[model samples]
Target: MNTIHFTNLPDDLPVAENEEQKKQELEFLKSAFQTFNETTRHLQESYDKLQERLNALDLELEAKNLELEKNLQEKERVKNYLNNILESLTTGVIVVDKNTRITTFNKTAGIILGMTAGQCLNQPLADTGIQPLAELVQSSGGQTRMEDHEITTRDQRQVHIRLSASPVQDPAGHRMGTVLILQDITQLKRLEEEAQRNQRLRAMGEMAAGIAHEIRNPLGGIELFASMLKKDLAQDPEKRPLTEHIISGVKNMDRIISSLLLFAKSPEPSRQQCNLNHLLKDIVNASADFQCPDNVKIHHDLAVGEAVAAGDEELLRQVFLNFIRNAVQAMPDGGSLRLTTQTGNTADSRSHITVTVADTGVGIAAQDQKNIFNPFFSTKDKGTGLGLAIAHNIIKAHQGTIDVESETGQGTKFIIKIPAWDEN
Candidate 1:
């Protein structure tokens, strides 16, 4: 504001002015004083209005600050929620930015890839040392999705993987990054293959059973004719030997046909309380007299209390005998043959009979162990290759399982599990 100065008298004021002039000066003073009073009032009114505007601005700023803070807190809560969901998933999750740099690596991702999150997070996909994932992500710039793509893990275990790649975009439809989902389907794949293999085996078994029936028809006639011939040639020594040979060949063929039928068309085992201890002892005695070498040492660990099984006694005996013979065959140059039996209950509270036939001899080749129970698979030249196969069928018919464990140059062990008889 500009200041105004007032004086008591002007420099050119007339001396001894009249009463009217004095009165005029007084009125001028009154006017200047009135104007000063009005100016002061106007200034006060303006200051009050300015104060109101400042207070309003302060209120607006505070409201805006609170709103901004709330938005930030909500965003943080959402981020944590999403992280929790990703972490809890069994399937693996990996995220990459537009530059193919890994942005998020979940725990499942770390486990499936056999790497740590720190080893991959924020790193370029190309340098992560996981080629399958890198190539999959780089394929079509992560826009194209790959589903159920199988990949072998770093540890060389075959894993069935269902991998998918999807692009991440912002609300404005702009390209942001990519997301990769991984799932382990190894067990599912094994079950699928096992189902397919079982179907094939079933078909093959049906065909073989039919062929066995067809062969048996002719074999019955041959045996009858050979018997008649043997009697007719009984008086002639040379001719009688030839007829006997013919009959012997027919019998062997019939025996093989019976074995084939047993393998192909497995018979249902008669449910009975089979005492494995007595059965095993009888088999051991028979083997000692026949197939078991004099140099081979036999050790039995058959306990007294491990008694009964819910299986046909004859069939169970056949299974155990087959295992014993295989174990003995494995040891040609004198080795220990161990046979053990025990009764145990499984986690499901079902009792089972555990039998192990192990030997200290040249072991089966690793490749052959899987095929040992398969028909016509044998490493020995004289092997008809049906012994273990028939044994496997009988065990299966009795609701049992058989598995072989062996390594090249190491001893082999056969583990058999059968459902035990419930006395209750």
Candidate 2:
């Protein structure tokens, strides 16, 4: 082997190293560089695209969050509005679960039921202790409809309540609960009752006046002839008895005619300032002369106040006398009669004095109660039935009112309200 220097290379030495090897080395190097550059560009493009996608996603999420917040706010607003409406409604509203447990009770419900929301909430229908309501709800099936129900209050007051019940259901149509709307018909019922009474009174009055007018002439002739016959038969003993009977009958007929006249006449009230307490005391004193039974007891609860009213004294006296007499007659089996007088403001904010007569006697029937103030409508055989009618008219003339509360076999109470004299 010849020891040649590495720096000293001969041109075209070593047979030119194979052309195929050189070409292969060059091709491999070119291919590696191209692959590296392509990978780098692809990574950069992919990163940029991922960054754009992330930004778009973030924007979308932000918009979705805002939309969600808006929806929540709108829902809250709707909820608040509904709550306010329910709170402000005059008619009572109550929501109950499927088990009839109270879920919500509004302000008016509190007043009508005489119970607070705190007391009523979560209470079962049976636990409410309202007999009418408990019975009604229990009997009502899964029917979702409204019905009118009458309930008696805790104070023994009759209330006409209109109960409207609707079924609460889920979006899937599954039965959830019930929503009950309570409407107070006490005043409405009273007005209806008053209207009916007035209609009956008008009809009866017209008929009575017509009949009385026709009968009065005949009655007068009968009385005149009876008087003349009594005078002519005075000397005949046998005819005297018959004439006496005729005279007695004529006098009775005259008395009936007088009552008829009183009934037919609708006198306008001549209002004057008078002390009601004194008048009530006089009425009590005058009642002593009445032939009341020994078993009946009368009590007076006259409040010490300025009991001045603008009304007719004589007519008012008759009104009270009729009430007292009726009360006395009510208690044939011995019961206490209480008369109370007090001054108060009416629901309409009118200053008035109230006189109440309560008797523990067989009460007027419900059917009869509506017609009690109509002329010729009487339960008693002998009653002309115009006493209450006249009393009703007298109170109305005075711009006052009269109401009766009664339960069959329980008792009866009559309330007379008259406007107080305005000193100012």
Q: What is the C-alpha RMSD of each candidate to the true structure, in Å?
A: 6.6, 9.1
Whole-model alpha-carbon lDDT for candidate 2: 0.80
**Residue 297 lDDT (model 2):** 81
lDDT of 1 by residue, 1-424 (tens): 4455565655575656655667876887687777888888898898889999989999999999999999999999999999999888999999899888999999898788777889888899777566677777778573767767566566654567888888888999887888888988877986785576557667767888899899999989988998999898888998888888988888888887787777777578999888888788888886453467798898989867856888898877777877788778878888899988898886677888888899988998755765676777888866768888778778877778777778777798888888999877
| lDDT for 53 (candidate 1) | 92
- At residue 337, candidate 2 shows an lDDT of 89
Q: Which lDDT values do the candidates have, in the order given? A: 0.80, 0.80
> Among all windows of ten consecutive residues in candidate 2, which has the lowest summed lDDT?
1-10
TM per model?
0.66, 0.69
| Ten contiguous residues with the weakest lDDT in model 1 | 1-10
